[model samples]
Target: MVEAQAPLKHGGWITFPFFIATMAGLTLAAGGWNNNVIVYLIEEFNIKNIEAAQIANIINGCVNLFPVVAAIFADSFLGSFGVIVISSSLSLLGITLLTLTAMLDPLKPPSCETGSSFCQNPSKPQLFVLYTSLALASLGAAGTRFTLATMGADQFNNSTHQGIFFNWHFFTFYAATLVSVVGIIYVESNVSWGLGFGLCVLANLVGLVVFVLGKRYYRLLKPQGSPYTALARVVVAAFRKRKELQSSNSQDYYDETQKGQRNIVGTTPSNKFKFLNRAALVTEGDTNLDGTIKRPWNLCTLQQVEDLKALIKISPLWSTGILLCTPIAIQISLIVLQALAMDRHLGSHFQIPAGSMIVFVMITTSIALAIIDRFLIPMWQKLFGRSPTPLQRIGLGHILTVSSMAISALVESRRLDSARSHKLYGNSAVPMSALWLVPQLVLVGAAEAFHFPGQVSLYYQEFPKSLKSTAAAMVAVFIGIAFYLGTAVVDLFRKTTGWLPNGINDGRMDNVYWVLTVIGIVNFGYYLICACLYKYQNVEKAELNDTNSG
Candidate 1:
């Protein structure tokens, strides 16, 4: 069976690049809205730092669950095709609604008298319309991301194609980021805010259309495994196996069904109760009364569940890691918005847009991931004899995160000094170019290259077939929890300090960066600990003897 499947599932080599392109498109089309939320909220609602961050937190946290929910519906009742179609259609409505809201009620005016746009706030109607629109956009992002990645994976046929898709996932991520970077930095910053969001909205609609157009090339998979169910089966099987090994009871071995009251058909219990009878089952023995051979019980055994249970449990580690690692993306929103608001040179001439650094990371990293997987992986494998596993890649990524955070801490510490120095001169805080954040941003992109690949592969690899979607959902859940936890941390700090002078008590953006830097370092340590303690799934070889594995 393994031999047969191996020959059939070989994917294409060149198709990898296009796969990455598709992945980039899918990723950017999915989550790009996250970066702009802080600025969007502040501008639209005239909210303070904590309030805006809270909203951003909510959006990120909620977006993940939608996919899990959709995946559930797809697996159980609606087929994958039906689920995708409904989601895509809803996606168009959500994106268009955001565009309409932004255009109809602009979040910011073109010009301000003092040239400090934060000085003037929007009216209530303007605020309400913008937020409502953003909420719609978030809705679109959730459903859109759910189908997009899985759909992109559809382009590859395991049997007919080569290994092109192995790398294509990364490529697709960059392609989407290309649009996001351009939209946020150039389109949104240079044109109107509405245009930036509208750009993604349009891009998403295109993505939806592309999916609909290519439905034929894609293979629809049947969702038979539920990870939660698989895990339960494993636990039960393990205990039963243990009991048999201990010779606890001859009848207790596989006769668990017989332990309960099971009436035969036409008995006192009623005909319906016959369905529950295990005593009348085709009992296995050396030979039956009809001289038939002995047989093993099916489905309700311990060994059957092991393959899936391992994946379900191991997935949480990667998921937890992603949750902790990715929400730093919020820095693009919360930190950048605060930086721009307080930067002395934030006027038109010296202005550095909030989303530009995130754009920089997206553009640069997308290119790098293409190079890393295609060009770098092979070279390293040849040189090292054995290449790094996904787990190894993730471990290395934490090192990069530590460095990025350290850089942020240093830049922020200096910004504080600069502010104080300018205060002495009776100026607005001393202005620094947003360029200071470049190192951190660049490192983040590199870290992502290391982190996302290993983590996602580990996820798909570990779980049983029935638990695939559940494994996917568990990953999403971990990330969601991490984002929510990060939000809570920020909110707690704000409530404690913001009421005091300068909110954080340091009186400026520099202080916030200082705190984030310290927290990032702590998170780095925590992640390392988690990684060290984590037990990985042992790879199982295909066994034709077992009907299930076969």
Candidate 2:
């Protein structure tokens, strides 16, 4: 008789602490450089304010965008553990280089005297080194960010445990980031850039080492082949069979094998995207006697067709997310510029770090996430007799986002009034307090608390099992796109209007916020339309089946 496989003792709660510690370290390391990069470029490299902002947006976009590629690599070839190890090493190297650049005067441009008419920009070699370091660091961060979440979730068997794991994952992520923004950024701004970057390098090394130490505890999964290939096949087959009529008979379609048996649950393809069902319509020569697919590109399984359908169904909802993030992206990049022009002093002792101002968003999101997960969700379930759906959560986020933009517009209007009254227009610093920017940041954070996790949950649950990692990184894809789009928007405004002039005090930033607010409102309406039309592909069925099974 064959021996039964032994259960893993090292996974579950045993591995949780290690994962948390590693994530904390990596978070601190990545956040340190990422948050303060614009400041570094402006102060050290003597780049223009708007130019630095654009570069920062592009860097943020790359950091978020590259995760999709990393996720695909992990899912299709390397698996999460291998990707994390490789990525962590890259991050360490990048941070070390950054530290060296800060410490060595030759690596940076000559420091410009305060109020100097001329400033020396970094040389070609310096720019090349800086870009290379950023590329390595971004690539490293991309690999670890969401893959670690997937790996941690894999340790749990059920959705409840997985949900709890995600909660802790995000909480730890935001908390660590908050610390970096507050502590490391403070050090960078006040003490020394080299010291701050040195800390990041140390954190990256520690995180990698801690992760390595926990290898025995990890439930290492071998990668299956690329899900994208299968998805692509479905689309190709559907197009090839476009002339063929789809059949109503279950026997006419190929049903995928599940647990050594044919899938009984999805015998009939979903009707939402009826056209894609043609891919699964089995012709006489399409299958072997054993029901194995003969010409894979010409015919696909019902599950494959359904997977494509699910993606198609969710595409409209996903598209809405891009617009939702674009305004937020624009706001985030510009806010730093706003902080630069405003009075950042809290008391006689300390002035707030410009990059650290983003901590308000992170802090608010973290707190809101905890409250929503622990208290709000329970209360919502109690009152409604069910948990709030991801769609509902995302819808609420849309509302908050619009509200935040409006509040931002109002705040900018007030700040402008103060600047004009004080005759500080075209001046470097306005007398208006930087704290006025907090409310909008907090509001945006609250919106993110609602939508970011909601998007992840929605995609994770709805996407094909093979594409889980891809689903997790889908939010990153749109956020990346939004950042790029935001850059274009900023560029457009710079060329076309005076709304985004280098000096915020001289420009009509309030108008830009108003424009974003208008865009948000329109996008929210589109989102509502999409959400209303969308039928939960797996959630309702999974819940109902669970109830029935119980």
Candidate 3:
């Protein structure tokens, strides 16, 4: 009798469709509620406009911030797939609760009359439920967002395939977000809030189901021991051996491969961060006879030492991202306010929803990303004989971001002029077209098309293999911090300058944009200095050398 053949393993291209569908559904679900939250709080919950904006910013920050913790959990304990399932379930529950709140009368306060002076605040229980729902949803969304990227990238082995996957991932993500901003926000504003949130609930369930269905076809990676521990060991060992003399001899360092563990070969310790090399020095009693570390915290491998050094080298570049993103974060919240104050009419029949204005940024970013990936990169490669590096892409983004702020300042000045000319400056909508806000939004979107992916790619390439998920999450963490910082900046302006009062119409909104413009230019100078001093840790040195030569 012939031997039975084992079943073929699943994964690779077989999982792409499932991952795309899941991503689209999740994006739609998250965006549907988040995009309209400020309006929801203002109109339904009877919250003040500025208060609602502040709440929305905080929520956005939480949604981005919690992902770093989720990434840690995935890397340290449960793998990405496990974390995703739990997180998606949490999201579904949150959306369900949110939808119920919309449908039920007791969950919200009585509807406020249009332009009413005294609106009833929500009861404490109602507020508690609302906050709880938001917390769960934000945490859930954050957990799945970037972890999914790491998971999808793991399904493929080829770098080119991984690159293509990321492009499609972002494309699907933005497209679904566009749908939520336009379609769901329109439903919530024009139709019924209940129906709109119900759609989000449905989307969440669908995304979760789709992801579960693809489990068998997924290349599920198990969690390696936490890389943070190794990093901590390096720091501890270095500090402990601070007084010890450094050695240039290779044999003086601990090599774990003698005991059958993998090791970094053919790379010498660099001169930079010379003190860290002490961590790997093989002093007496640092290692056992079997080549295992006697005390892991007292001695680390050369690879661990090098890994810490890489992170240290990239930290300055990492810090620049916070400043880089703060302006964009502030602009995102403020643009909605701007739209609310402008005439949002298209032609004679239809009026645009103020919350839906962000779709312009999403749409532009999607288109620009496609053009850059398909046309610009190839052309640059042909002309320069080397692909554009992340630093170059990020530098272009800085330029574009600065330009966008200047355009924003100019446009706000024009809108202020329109407001003043019509004598409707105090808390009332201006006759100026909302289309005036389009140029700045488009420019910012183009900047994102360059910098966002560049940052992700940069982190993925430079980070150690064990911290792959964490690397993907670094961008989210940056944006999260930026959002919080942006909130602080806005509060500062409100307290100090009158640039951003409760109603932006009566304030010097243009001045705020100009301030951001100056900040962007200064930040760009700082970024350039960091970029110049930085050497590639994981990338080919030849790329930069060749660029310089050309």
lDDT of each: 0.54, 0.85, 0.85
Sort order, lDDT high to low: 2, 3, 1
Which candidate gets the maximum lDDT versus the true structure? 2
For 1-550, candidate 3 gives per-residue lDDT tens digits of 0111223365688999989999999999999999988888877888767667888888899888888888778776888889999998999888888888899999999997623577798999999888888888888898899888878888887889998999899889988998999999999888999999999989999999999999888877767666888999999999999999988777777656755442435245778899999998878897667667888999988878888888998888989999899899888888887887889999997889889988888888889988998999999989978788888888889989999999999999998888888887545789889999999999999999999888988898888765665786788888999999998988898899988776667789899899999999999999998888776767566667433211
Please write out the lDDT profile of model 2 over residues 435-485, one tens digit for every residue: 999999999999999999889888988787767767878999999999899
In candidate 2, clashing pairs total 0
Extract clashing residue pairs from model 3.
Answer: none
User: Mind giving the per-residue lDDT tens digits that candidate 1 earns over 113-163?
Assistant: 322335566667756665665666566556545555554444455634423
lDDT for residue 311 in candidate 2, whole number 0-100:
89
lDDT of 2 at 408: 93
The TM-score ranking, best first, is: 3, 2, 1
- Candidate 2 regions exceeding 4 Å error are 1-10, 113-116, 158-161, 259-266, 378-385, 425-427, 541-550
